[model samples]
Target: MSVKKISRHSPPNCGARAASASVLALMALLGAAAQAADTYNSDRPGGADHRLLSRYQGSLLYMYGEEALGKADMLFDDKGKPVMRPVEGRISNRMYWGPKKKSPLEVYRNYRHALETAGFKTIYACETKQCEAGAVQDAVQDLPRKVVWKDSDIFVENTFNSANQPGFHYYSGRRTGPDGDTYVSVALAGGYEDEPVFGRVRQFVQIVEPATAELGKVSVDAKAIGGALKRDGRIALYGVKFDTGQAVLRPESTAQLAEMAGALKAAPALKVYIVGHTDNQGELQGNSTLSQKRADAVVAALSSKYGIAPARLLGRGVANLAPLASNDSEAGRAQNRRVELVVR
Candidate 1:
């Protein structure tokens, strides 16, 4: 028998025990004999119905109870800024725990029960096992997914998992940001859209909303892009040696110079401000000075090697005033040390 799995990021006993017990109880009430013959759909209200919605939402909502604690653990990047990453992908899974004779739909209903019992606040879309390809929007568009595992679309859970915790998932889509550049995404599980089935009849769903145009598949030349964008915007560089806590520009940093040069050529009119940020490890003032030094170093590279007009370049030092990670830990502090570019 395929055992149901909770978000596995936490200690099994800490945040997940209630959901487990609830699922077990619901299964007992529904009778172990229940089986699903087909998947559920929202359009066919009679087919899947509000009863199922209540069940699904109830489970997901229960799961959300632990979200508060998860959010507490999040850390910011340097400059006390939250890191902005985009959605990667969404994934879902389900298992059969009830009677062996039910229709696939009935079996999927039980799967919803399990998710509900486990505390997920979810909504149903196309209850059937069909999904369309290509960029799809709308609540139902996300569901009715073609289940390769069992060939059906079941339900879309409505609640989101916090990024701070384990077992949560993310979704990705394409959209244009205010800056008009495409970026990639990272989001909570069930944020994207997908349907999965297992053990012959059970169903699960993953949801992803449309993304900003700024996000897409990451380009291979992010470093190059970094350079070009730097000239028109604030750009800073630090010498980084892999696996070392120290910061200094290495030979590879020259690549960033090319990026800045490219940006300068693209938008000669754009002005930029470069500031440095660092993780809080040692003296705050010292950290600030180091960050400033890194920014100055980048400025010097652009002026001396690339021969960019000095009027377009500006640099300043900022120390531990910005951090990408936590000072409490080495990893956080390491990520904290860096440079920033402000585009005007």
Candidate 2:
């Protein structure tokens, strides 16, 4: 299920028009309030401020969320492409709604200055050329699974993904420190051919603080995987790591995914169920949805990246129903959060 493509309104001034055209046609009730300082209301009920940076005064915060471990594309490579870097620490995404007259370039430049003034060195700056969608989507799409998102979040995500495509500005910078580095990427656009009420300019901001990904926490050894499957019906794998609220496996999980592929190759006739399990933190239904997506992600990764046969692997999600350990404590919860391969 792909997100609805709606931000088709490309500003006339923005050089490259987005492939399509459509501003977010939100529900009438919600659309009226997307702006923070509208005629009747000027209240800030949503998250007012982000930790590393402050919000632009005039814009309304459409959405705000953070991830413990997430992926973000940062510095540009020699080919002038954004590098998809895994953020180890806290990843904060803030989406804002800007006034129509204001072009996206203005807000983007202000954000660039803020980062630079705060000691962040500009690493990737492509002001005129359009920014890549992956760098923007990575931040916009990562939301917590536990909470029921507001209508505004969906609207913001849809609008920015379309608006940031072409005729926009992208800037990413990093700051070095003794402990680690901080990364910030800003994507914004201001060209609306259609509805003016939906917001002429929108900005998507992602900030990554330094942290550890618990590297080498687990080894993806085919021999061990095979041995465990031979002895037991299934084996629990923690090596397939995910952010607190994300289903996509972390880059660190590549080794494990590769080994899983190897294990399947060793036994040509082997057919197994790839089961996704989660801690009992959020609602059961929500956890089940996340688990299912994760199971599907693993299956897709195996099929696409490792050349594992799709027929050989079946994906399922049992949510918190099958717990490896008690969910009473943090350690137990961590133990319970795992992906398992059970022999069929």
Q: What is the C-alpha RMSD of each candidate to the true structure, in Å?
A: 20.8, 19.6
Q: Which candidate is the best by lDDT?
A: 2
Clashing pairs in 2: 8-21, 8-22, 11-191
Instruction: Supply candidate 1's per-residue lDDT for 27.
Output: 92
Where is model 2 more than 4 Å wrong at Cα? Answer: 1-46, 130-154, 160-167, 191-199, 213-344
lDDT of 2 by residue, 22-107 (tens): 23334544667665336213323566567778866677666666677655655554466656454446677776767556767777
- Tens-place lDDT per residue, model 1, 216-323, is 112223355445565444333443221233445556666555655666656677566666676666787776667667667677777788877777778777777756
Q: How accurate is candidate 2 locally (lDDT)?
A: 0.72
- Backbone clash total, candidate 2: 3
Query: What is the Cα-based lDDT of residue 6 in candidate 2?
Result: 52
